[model samples]
Target: ASAKARLIDVFDLSDVQATYILDMPLRRLTKFSRIELEKESGELTTTIEELTAILDDDGNLRQVVSDELAAVGQQHATPRRTLLLEANASPAKSAVPLEVDDAPCIVLMSSTGLLARSADTEFDASADIARAAHDVIVSSVPATARGEIGLVTSAGRVLRLSVLDLPALPSVIGIPALSAGAPIGAFVDLPANEQALCLTTLDETGCIALATARGTVKRVVADTPGSKDSWEVIRLEDGDRVVGAVRLDDAAARTAELVLVTSDGQLLRFPATAVRPQGRAAGGMAGINLASGASVIAFGAFTPTDDAMLITIAGTTAALPGIDTGSMKVTPFAEYPAKGRATGGVRCHRFRSGEDLLTLAWVGNGPVRACSSSGVPVPLPTELGKRDATGVPVAAPVSHVAGSL
Candidate 1:
């Protein structure tokens, strides 16, 4: 009664509430009801003590406020709507190029200008090509796996390719074969109707020699390494286009002979130095005067040491004697007197009765081997003979250059 009276006094209960409490039903004052009221009273007393304690210390009060705020935040939280990036994550104008270790590699280009790289210096001709049925290996070069390769197009432009950028192929049957590769047009923005003619490794120490179908030739200083932009290596006339490109050093240019073979079996050999080095954009000077219906088929720098072999399209192989380094006097096997530029070259091979043209010419110091278009080995006679001899025929036609990877 005293506790109830004190509560009513603290709450300022009116006379009507006091009367109601006095007139409470007897059922409302059961033992369970008394126990529930006692529990509620105890909870209220504990809450009052906690509130007093929190009010007594600033830290306790702040903690209570922080806890309430956290609870409210958790109940009302929503998912984020914007993403956050790193402080320096802005987009750039160009992508960074990749760096790789230098290793031996073979770069292959298809007839349709597709390009690929293999880790091996040699390819398995017997294995199936990693390209379409119509595509064939038109040009290839041995170079460092990470070196830069120059791609010459029929339009006389040179597009640069990093050997590392090419896809590497797996080795099968002891030789690596390019399984798949990107097209040259993807890396080079070639003009319409332009097609890739040849491929060569690029370096700063050498010069690039270009030969065109119309018998024009030019030697241009090689551009510095690491350039990705395509440049004009040779300027061509309306009807003329590049057919071949060779790398030559200053010393090699002085002694090495520039050999050009025509479709009619005519071969011209002259000092490479005869054609002075010109700028990349300069139109090349005449290299040979093509006969009325004859066209230049192949051009390369020939360093004669032991022999030069002429392989005809009809599969005839003839070995021509070269520099006789064995004798006390280094005598050439055949005296191909140096001629002025634009002169029709002397005969290199006498066409057989049925044979019409020559397809490949090789110059090396040691014995040479023949590889077929399908990667099989083709046998050749070991006999060394005089120049301008008729080539011995084989079973199949020689489609590409001998020893060209």
Candidate 2:
């Protein structure tokens, strides 16, 4: 009782006269009148509103304060004029030009030449010691029909060079020959396997020459009456005979499945076994272009061109489209135009791995471009020069006169 009295005292409940009215009977409560009840109800409502206001203030006190300040400012402020400012933004510019480093220049022909001129600023020096001297030879000389100037190092090592990093030296050495008097033109070094293949022209025979590191030379000749062009040595795999070569003027190999683009632009294929011994195109049966000696016996179409066919060493043929050299777009092979119209028939050469085919193409005024099996073009550095009918670069070393990497 004492505690309850204290709580009531603290809460100020002693002013309520309803305690005695509640203890009276229902009839006696009616005597208290509705006026008193209404007054009490109004007091209870005010108390609840005050409690709610306190709770609201505690929950978001800072927000409530800020909102209250904003409300007060808005209620008392006057409108002001607004001003707008516009600034132009420009696109970012490159710091240098893409073609600046591609300027033409003379390359050094030997390590001694490169090392001697290493400190000189006359020519941009490349770090490829192996190709330094070869690049110099290829760039300084003029193209001649006699034969592409063979690049031999002071150590008597042959260089398979690429024009990509001109003024660079060759890093590889020692390739074989396809035949006697066959001049090796260009070649690539298989660094991983320590072997190399050279593209060369046989003496006066117009035969395809391939030299290997094993001191072996293999030759494939298209002795047919109408075959006057040379063959480009595309790639070398397996052995001296297991190589791939492509005709520069046409997209066909020597032997395997014969894919011939006729003078009228009609494509045709013949199997090695089905080739007639004495009939038309006889004794001219397509033979394996390289030395690996793999046999080709099937025929298939690789393109829609009635004149283009894919000839495999196994005698299989695939039809492809004819290359419209005049209308084709000329871009770096790596940056082949994806949106350009189909200008040339596609020729595919399957590598030993058989995953993809290497596609060589002739486009408008541009050198033949080699595309990967997946259609990604392998950009041949301009220094390599343009390919000839045999798919080999013409004997012009001057075309390789490019600056530096």
Candidate 3:
């Protein structure tokens, strides 16, 4: 009735008994009599022939048993456990009980009042091994509960703080001319050698602020207060005029150049450099009426219907097909009207990548529709909403106002 039960499982075998069962000389077992086998039924016994047969198999039986017993010993070995205590408790009385299948050779409490176990009897309670085990357990705790673990290094740095413990990032800093109390709306970093000017309406006074690498501070316009629609023109070193007023949404640098949309839906570019006082009237175009007149200027590759013409000092002229400028023929120096829309006002137009112009027309109360330069309608993003100065969606409930800067 010899069964395959492990030799160690059958009796309270000591380490020596296990070793003898696996490593005893095979010649000793072959001489055992039937009476001895009956007396030690569960004991290790084998004949020379049995040993030879086991050896002849693909795998040796004794070797297999030895390997299995070694694995079992390791599996049943006393495991190190750690128990973290509250910060207010003292280690002498606050140490928690550690449940284990086998008793450890040594047990000690950590500086954080955590219970630690080890197999070596000479194990130091403050040794690196115990500390390492304690640290592993504490580090694996959730970030929210890590503060309760009360574990710190010699240098006073917390051990288990995770990313969740860190505070949220601060908003981008250093905005120009932004009042300390005013909330920031938009921001943009100007290119090197580029200056951004902002026009702000403070206390009903038109104030101008220049943003350079040096700093952002406001300067009084010193000019006459005109209509809110009054524009500023600046002349560039390249002999081009940047026409338009500037409005600052945040401390970010913004150019003074603005695009004005007239009642007739004509777009014009007024450079910031060419702005100057013109008689009693201080408006853009320097008193130059471009409605019936034609001016050639280099404009962006794509322009909305609001930007119909660019009034630059340079001899560069670009056409914006988004705005139905009434069959206006775009020439080198002038844009002449070719045909006019039958009805309804022109809608906002935008240029896609390259020279592709997209015009969005608000025809009646239906959905805003878009069309290509060739009179072909195009699809737009479904999430289209009122965008802020930086093209981000504006929160619900918006208000529009007019003022000069």
User: Which lDDT value does model 1 have at 169?
Assistant: 58
- Candidate 2: tens digits of C-alpha lDDT, residues 172-217: 2221001111112223222333322222222223333222222222
Model 3 misplaced regions, further than 4 Å: 1-256, 277-405
List lDDT for all candidates, in order.
0.64, 0.28, 0.26
- Please report the candidate that would top lDDT against the real structure: 1
Candidate 2 vs. true structure, TM-score: 0.17
Q: Model 1, 247-315: lDDT tens per residue? A: 666676778777776877676778788888888878989899898877787777757764544443322
Q: In candidate 3, what residue range of length 10 has the lowest lDDT sum? A: 175-184
| RMSD each, Å | 26.5, 28.9, 31.2
**lDDT (Cα, 0-100) at 96 in candidate 3:** 57
Ranking by TM-score: 1, 3, 2
**Separate clash counts for every candidate:** 3, 54, 25
